[model samples]
Target: MRLHLRLILTVLLAGFAALVAAGPAAAHVVPSTVLQLDVHEDDITVEMTLPTTDLVTASGIDVPVDGTVPAAAAEQLAAYVEEHFDVTIAAASDATSATGTWNVDVGDVATAEVEQWGTGAFDAVTATATLTPPAGADLRSFTLDYDAILHQVVTADVFVLLRSDSSTGEVEQTRSLGAITLDTVTGTVSPLTVDLAGGSARQGFTGMLLLGISHIAEGTDHQLFLLTLLLPAPLLAASLAGDRAGRSRHWREVAPTRRAVRRITTTTIAFTIGHSLTLALGALGLPVPQQPVEAAIAVSILIAAAHAVRPLFPGREPLIAALFGLVHGMAFSTTLSEMELSGTQLVLSLLGFNLGIELMQLVVVLLVLPPLIVLARTPAYRPLRTTAAVVTAVAAVGWLLDRVGVPTPLSTAADSLGSVSPWIAATLWIAAALVLLGTRGRRSGIRRVVSA
Candidate 1:
C-alpha cells in the first residue's frame, strides 16, 4: 500500500510540475472566444466575442478595438468569420460523413473591452450573425464547424454557449455546449458537437418551470420577505404585536390552526397574484428600470421584516403582500423578458415559469409554516420568533444597502444563507419535536401528581 501511495504521489507531483511549467506558455497560445447562440422562432442568431488581438493575428490585418472596428477592417473580419463559421449535419444511418448547408448573414462588428477570466480589459469584437437552417432541419443537433481563429492560430479555444432557445425554455443563463479548438497532436481544428438533449416544446416548458422553481429557491429577498411576514402568523396580535390590538378579539392568545392556515393561504395567493400580473406585463414588453426594481425588492423585504417585528400591518398581511408582490413581479419579469420570447412561445414560457415558481413557493411555505405554528403553542416560541425576525431585518438592511450600490459582507453572507435552508428546516423540525415532547411529559407528570 505504501509503495502504491508513493507512486501515486510521485505521478501527481510530476503532473503538477508539468502544469506549472506550461501555464505561462498556455496563456499565450490563444485567447478564447465566447459564442452565444439563441435559437429563435424561425432562425438562429449567434453573438460572438472574439479577442481583437487574436482577430488581427488571424486576419493579418489591423483590427481596431478603440471604438468600432475601422470600416475596411470590419468588413474583412465579417467576411472571414462568415466564410469560416458554419453548422453541419450529424451523420445518420451508416453515413461516413456529415453533410449539410446553412445560410449565414454576417453583421457588423463593434469593439469593446471584456473582463472575462481576468483577461484585464482586453479589446474584443462583437458580432451578431443569423443562421437559417434548411427546410425541416433540426436546429438542436448539429456540428458547429467554427474555424474563425483556430485555422490561423491553431491553438485558439472557442467556447460555444447557448443563451436561450425559446422553443425549449432555455434562457437567460450561459450554458456551455462544448469547446472548439485545434488538436495539438492531430494539427486539426475539431468541430464542436452541439446536441441540446431532447429538444422539444415540452422540454422548453419544463425548463421554464425548473427555472421558476430555482428562482424562488435562490432569491433571498423574496424568500425572506414572505417568511418574515409569516413569522408572527400564529400569535395573537395584541400578545406579540406592540400596537396591533383589537384586530381579532382573542387577545393574549395564539391563533387557531384554521386562522393561521387562512392567513398563510391568503397572503401567498395575494403575493402570487401581485407578481403574476407584473411578470406578464414585463414579459409582454412593459418598460422596467432594473436598478430601481432591485432596490424596491430590498426595500419591500425591509418593510416586511419591520412588520414582522412590530404590528405594522396587523390583519392586512395579504394586502401588504399584494402591493409588494407587484414590485417582485417586475423583478421576476426581468428574467422572462431577457429570453426575448415572442407570441405563443412567450405565453407558454410564462405559464410554465410561473407555475414552477408557485410550486417552489408552496414548498417553502409548507416546510417552514408547520414548525412555526407548532412552536407558537410553546412558551419558548415568542422569543425565538422575535430573534428570527430581528436577524431577517438585519439581512434585509444589508440587502437594501447592497442593492443601492453599497458593498457589504452582510449581503454576501445573507445570500449564502439560502444554500443552508434545508438544514434550517431540519433544525426547526427538531426543535418543534422537542418542544412537543416536553409539553407532553409535563402534562403526564401533572396527571400523576394529582392521582397520587
Candidate 2:
C-alpha cells in the first residue's frame, strides 16, 4: 500500500511539475497574453492570444463581451496590433553585425471563449502576424518590440514561446523564450531578445523519439489493446470437441517457456511492422478518417479481449497483432500531422517517433509478461486471466461507443485507467515475486522430507 501511494503521488507530482514548467512567465492569478512564434528559414509567424478585457482596456476598441467583434472594431483592433508589435534583428556580440526591422503583417482577427489550463474560461481575441526579416538579416535571434496590452495594463504579462522551428528540428515541442513584462522597480517595458540555438538532424530525431515514448506512455487505449492480446500467449490452444463455431479453440495447459517466448517475440515484432507502415503513410499526408480509425482501434481491442477468453485465432496471434497494429498506427499519425511538419523534418520526426513507440512497448512487455507466464502455470491463472480480459472488454466497449459519438459512464471510468496504471503495474510485480517465492519454498520442503 505504501508503494502504491508512492507510485500514485509520484505520477501526480510529475504532471504538476510539467504544467508549471510549460510557461514560466504565466504565474499570475488573472489571465495573461500568450504569444507563440513559428520560426522558418526566412521569416517568423506570431500567434497572439489576447485577453478580451485587457485588449479593450489597452486599445479602447469597444469589443463586446459576448465573444464577437464588430466589423469597425475588428479593423481598429488589427491596426492597433500592427502599431504596437515589431520584430528587429539583434545586435551581434562583436558590434559589427547589421541591424534592421522586419516587415510586420497582422490579419485574421477573431474572438472566442477559450479555457486555458488553470485559468478557466475567458473571452479572448486571437490573431496571426508574419514578421519577415530584411534580405540578409538573421531570423534565429531577434528583438521583439511588443506592447499591445502591457502599454496600458502595466500589470499584464506576456509569455513568448517557440511553437515550431523546422531549422532547429523543434517540431512537436514548445520552448519558452522569455517573458515581456514591465520591470516593477524601474516601471518600464524593455524589448525582448530571443536567441535560439542551432540544431542538427540528430536533435530533431531525438525530439521525435521522446515524443513517441511520451505518446505511448500517456495513451492508455493503445497500451490496453496491445497488452490484452498478449494475455493468452503463454498457453496452448486446444480444439473444443463439440464447438458451435467449427474453428473455435480454448486456452489449455501452459506452453514450454521457449515456445511462449517465441510466440511473444513474433507477435510484438509483427505488431511493430504493421504500425510502422501506416504511420509513415499517414504522416506523409495520407488522408486518415479520424473517427472511423479510432472506432476500429476500439474494435481491435474488443476482438483481442475475446481471444484471451476463448482462442479466436489460436496459432495466428502475430497476424492478428499486425492487422490491429495498422489501425493503432493511424491513430499515432494524427499526432504528427497536427505538428505540421514537412520535408526532411517530417521524415526525421517519423523515424524518431516510431523508435520511441517501439522502445516503450518493449519496456511494458518486459515488465508485465514474464510474471504472467509464471502465473499461467499455476491454478489461479484461469481466474486471473478471465478477470483481466473481462475488465479490458468492458473498457473496449465503452471506448467503442464513445468514439462512435455516444457517451457513457463506462467510457469515463476507462479514461481513469491511465492514472491508476502505475499502481496496477506495481501490484503485478509484487504478486509475481510472491508466487515465485512460494513455489521455491514448496520445492525446498519436498526435498527435505525426501532426505529425512
Candidate 3:
C-alpha cells in the first residue's frame, strides 16, 4: 500500500511540474485587424488597419496625435517605421520596386496616405497607396515586405491577426517575421529572411509529421484524456466476476494490456482522422465557424474523461472515442487552418501534420504502458486506478467549466501538464526497471519457499 501510494505521489508530482512548465507556451488568441493588398500592372496597392494596442505592444512607440512629440522623437519614430516596414513589387523578367518604402517614385505614385482613427476599442491606423508601374514592367508577383511592430520599439513582437485576398475572400498566406534588428541611431530596418514558401511534397510530409507530433506533445487536453483512459486498465481483472477456471483463461490474463493498448490506439487514430478531415476541409476554403468548434472540443474532452470512470458506453469505448474524436479533430484543424496554404500545399500539410500527431501519440503510449501493465498485476491496483480516475474526472470538470465560459485553476493546471513529459518518461523508465528486478526476486523467493 505504501509503495503504491509513493508511486502515485511521484506520478502526480511529476505531472504537476510538467503543467507548470507548459502553461505559458500554449498559443494565445488575440483580437483581429485587416490587411488588404491589391496588385495591378504598373505597381501594387497596399492597405491595412492595425490595432493601436497591438502596434504599441509590437513596436514600443506610442504615437499620439494629441500628445507632444519633440522634433528628435518624431524623426526617431519616422526612422523606425522606415526601417521596419517594407513593400516590394517582384515583376516578370527580374524587375522589382520597393513600394512600401517612403520614397519609391514609380511614375505618378499618387494618392498615398496613412491615417489613424478612433481612441477606444475599435481604434486602428491605416496605410494606403497607389503606384504607377514603370513602363514595360511585369506585375505577376508582388512581394510585400512588412513587420508592422518591429521598427519603432526594439523589444516588440509582431503577430498577424488577419490577412485576406481582395478578389476571392480567401485568407492569404502570412509568415511570421522572425527576430528582426533595427539600427538604434539611424532607425534603418534590416528584415531577416524566414522563407514562407510552401515546400515540396517530401518537405511538406516531414513538416507535417513534426507538426502532428508537436501538437500531441503540447496538447494538455489530449494527454489528460489518454491518461484517464489508461487509469482503469490495471484493475480490469479485479473488476470482473469469474470462476477459478475463468480467472486462469489466457484472455483474462492479457485482457488489460490488450484493452489498454486498443483504447489508446483507437482514441489516437480517431482523433487523427477527425482532425485530418476538418483540417483538409477548413484549409480548402470551407467555412468553419471557429468558436463553436473549439467549445465543442472542450466539451468532448469532458465527456471522455467522465466516461473513463463510469463507462459511459461500456463495450463500445472505441465508438465513443471516435465520436468525441470528431470534435477534437475540429479543434486540431484550427492550427492548420491558420497556416493559409494553397490547394496542393494544403493537402500535403494535412497529411504531414496528421502523421506527426500519430507519431507523438505512439511515443507517449509506449512510455506509459510498461508501468501500467506491471502495476495492474499488483494487489493495490484497484485503489490506484480509482484514485487516478477521480483526479482525472475532476480535472476534466475544471476544463469543461473553463471552456464553457468560467475559467478556473483546474483547467489552467491541466493545460500546463505537457511540460513534464521528459521527466515523466525518465521516472517511469526507472520504475519499470526496478519493478522487473523486484518481480524476479519475488519469483526466486517463492521457489525457495516451495523447495524448503
Q: Which prediction has the highest lDDT against the true structure? A: 2
Per-residue lDDT tens digits of candidate 1, residues 304-386? 77776666777898999999999999999988886778887888899999999899999999999998898788666655666
Candidate 1 Cα errors over 4 Å, as ranges:
1-31, 59-80, 88-127, 134-137, 171-175, 183-188, 193-197, 239-253
Whichever of 1 and 3 has more lDDT, that candidate is 1
**C-alpha RMSD (angstroms) for model 1:** 10.0
Candidate 2's displacement at residue 402, Å, is 4.6
Each prediction's number of clashing residue pairs: 2, 0, 15
- Using TM-score as the yardstick, the better of models 1 and 2 is 2
Q: Write the per-residue lDDT of candidate 2 for residues 314-416, one digit (tens) a residue.
A: 8899998999899899999987775667888888889999999999999888977897788787766676677678777888898899999998666776766
lDDT of 3 by residue, 148-265 (tens): 5644445443332223221222233343334344566777655433222232467556656666776778887787666666554433332345555443322123245666677667
The residue pairs in collision within model 2 are none
TM-score of each: 0.79, 0.81, 0.64
Looking at candidate 1, what is the lDDT of residue 66? 81
Show the lowest summed lDDT stretch of 10 residues, model 1.
Answer: 20-29
**Where is the poorest 10-residue window by lDDT in model 3?**
104-113
Q: lDDT of each model, Cα atoms only?
A: 0.78, 0.81, 0.55
